[model samples]
Target: MAALEGRGLRKQFGGVVALNGIDLDIDTDQVVGIVGPNGSGKTTLFNVVTGVHPATAGTVSWQGQDITNIGAHRIARKRLVRTFQQAMSFPGLTVDENVRIAWEQGRRGGSRWASPAMILDFVGLAPLGRAIAGSLPFGSLRRLGLAVALGVSPELLLLDEPGAGLN
Candidate 1:
């Protein structure tokens, strides 16, 4: 059985069809990429699967159980995590603090006060750990985003346009 499967998934935005009967099967420990031109429904598909948006039609199965309309936090508890195309950060927080927040929220195995130094080192942000996230360059912010997602310890990681703004 596949780790995740979508059967005839459909989503509509008013009169426009965002996803039309899309089907996909992903197995454990596999690397799959979804590529297409703009407005091809990639983000919509992720949103539906991750519970950001309810599907207009079809079913989603994860580990043989139906999860089509599960809430986002519920899905995350089930080990499915996703990252946005645009890097998101708490502008007022330090880089290390931002990562720490994610670590705590994602419920990774660690103390709430785990060494910020260690976490920064693990994500290659040691040098910038003390810097304010809002003041960092775009590339560094992107890395920060990845580090935050990694903190979630996801079974399934969905990255949307991870390289979108890279120079």
Candidate 2:
């Protein structure tokens, strides 16, 4: 069974169609990329699959179980997490604190890296752990976001524009 699957997915915002009958399947440990020009439905697909936005039609499943519209929090609890196109973090908090928050709120299933510190190290942000999130450079901010997502120990991570800030 696929770890994540979207069948006939469709999302519409008023008269605008974001996604139209999209079908996708991701197996465990598989790396997939969705590429398109600006204004394409790439982000919309992530939003629907992650439950950040409801699909106008179609079904989403995780491990063969229907997860369509179940809500983003619930999906995250299932160990399915995602990062945004822009670096998303608590600007007022330190890098360490931001990752710690994700650890506290995220699902726990005993990943090899057990703590936020470990996650920061894994993402190559250990030296900057104490820095304010908003003060970091764009690349560092992106890494910080990755560290926070790692804090969740996600089974399947969907990175939206993962290289956006790195370049």
Candidate 3:
């Protein structure tokens, strides 16, 4: 069975339809990218599948289990994570501290998960761990957003416009 499936997914915000008759099946260990121009349902699709918005019709499933209409936090708890088109971080905090907060949110058990330092290192932001998140350049902020997403170590990571703001 596919790791993720969406069938006839539809999302309507009041009068406008964001997604109509969307269908997709993604197997495990595969990397797929969603591409489209602005206002195209790319982010909307992610939002629907990840429970950021309640679908007006159809369903979404993870590993054959129905997850349509589930809340975003609930979806994350199921090991399905997502990143946003805009930078998502505690701009007032240090880069390391921002990642640490995400780690705490995503860690599932008593055992220590990947350290914030390790994640920052992986994202090439280790050198700036102590710097203020708000002070970093746009490209670095994007990377930091990715690092924060990695803190969860989600089974399925959905990136929204990963390169949107990069130089």
Candidate 4:
């Protein structure tokens, strides 16, 4: 069974057809890429798959289960994770704290006090663990976003533009 699949997925914004009858299927441990021009529905497709936006038509399935209109957080809890085009980080939190929070949320029922050091080490941020996330360089921030997404150990990892803005 496919880990993620979409059939006849469609979305529109005031007559601007973002996606039109798109079909996609992804199995486990697959590396897939969707490339297109600026407005070629790339982000729209991710939005639909990640449940960030409701599809105007068609169905979305994960692990053979229908999730056409599921909520984003719920999807994340189910281990279908995605990162945004822009890097997202909690400015007020330390790098270690951010990773720790993600690690805790990923396990769903795990304790927060367990093995934060391990997560920091896994993301290669052990040295900067105490550093404030907002104070990091752009590249580091991007890596931090990846680290957070990895916390869930997702079956489907959607990276919008892992390398969008960098100097």
Candidate 5:
């Protein structure tokens, strides 16, 4: 069985249809990317697949189980995680604190292969580990969010736009 699968997935927002009957099958070790023009249902697809938004129709199967319409937290527990284009960080927390929070809230075992410091370093935010999250610029915040997601040790990582605002 595939690690993740989506069939007949569709998402509609009032008058517009974001996704229309999409099907996907991904193996445990395979990497897949979704690309399209702005507002082309790419983010919406991830949103539905990761349970950030409910699918108007269709199903998402993960690890051989139907996981459509599940909450984001529940899906995250299964090691299927996502990061948005926006900086979804704790504004009042420090960069280091943000990484720590994600490591703590992550799955039963957030692979100790790398520490919080290492993850921050990998995302190029190590120097700002002590900086306040709210005071950072947009690009820095985006990196912080990515570092947090990496701390989760997700089996499936969906990044909305990792390079959207980078220079």
Candidate 6:
């Protein structure tokens, strides 16, 4: 069975049809990229699959289980996590604190990285762990977002525009 599957997925915002009849199957350990022009429904696809937004039609299955519109938090607990296009963090908190919270809130038993520090290191943000999240540069913020997603110990990670703020 595919690790992740979306069949006939469609999302519409009022009259705007963001996705139409999209079908995809991702196998275990497979790296897939969805590329399209601006406003081409890439983010919408991620939102639908990850439960950030409800699909207007179709289904999303993870490990052969129906997970469509199950809610984002529940999906995260299932070890499926995603990053946002915009770098997301608690502005008032230190970088370390932000990651620590992510780890605490989303920590499951099977994380590849053993701790929050490891996740920061993996994203090249260990040195700035003490810095306030709001004070960081754009690229660092993007990396922080990635680190936060990793802190959740996801079995499957969907990164949206991961390279957006980076060189």
lDDT per residue as tens, model 6, 1-167: 79899999999999999999999999769899999999999999999999999999999999889999999888878888899998899999999999998788665565566788998998999999999999999999999999898887778899999899886
Per-residue lDDT for 122-150 in model 3, tens only? 88999999999999988899999998888
- Write one digit per residue (lDDT tens) for candidate 5, span 6-114: 9999999998898999999987678777778988888899999999999999999999989999888899889898899888899999999999888776645747535
- Candidate order by decreasing TM-score: 6, 5, 2, 3, 4, 1
Model 2 residue pairs with clashes = none
- Models 1 onward score TM values of 0.87, 0.93, 0.91, 0.89, 0.94, 0.95
Alpha-carbon lDDT of model 2:
0.90
Each model's C-alpha lDDT?
0.83, 0.90, 0.87, 0.84, 0.88, 0.90
Candidate 3: segments with Cα more than 4 A from true spot: 109-113
Report how far off residue 146 is in candidate 6 (Å). 0.4
- Top candidate, metric TM-score: 6
Model 2 / residue 59 / CA error / Å: 0.1
What does candidate 4's lDDT look like per residue over 1-167, in tens digits? 68899999999898899999999989878998899899888998999888899999999999988988888888878788999887789989999888878877767754323576776676577899999999998878887888888776677789888777544
**Deviation of model 6 at 97, angstroms:** 1.1
Q: What number of backbone clashes does candidate 1 have, counting pairs of residues 3 or more apart or in separate chains?
A: 0
Q: Indicate whether candidate 2 or candidate 3 has the larger lDDT.
A: 2
Flag regions of model 6 displaced more than 4 Å.
none
All-Cα superposition RMSD per candidate: 2.7, 1.5, 2.0, 2.6, 1.4, 1.2
**Cα deviation of 45 in candidate 1 (Å)?**
0.9
RMSD of 6: 1.2
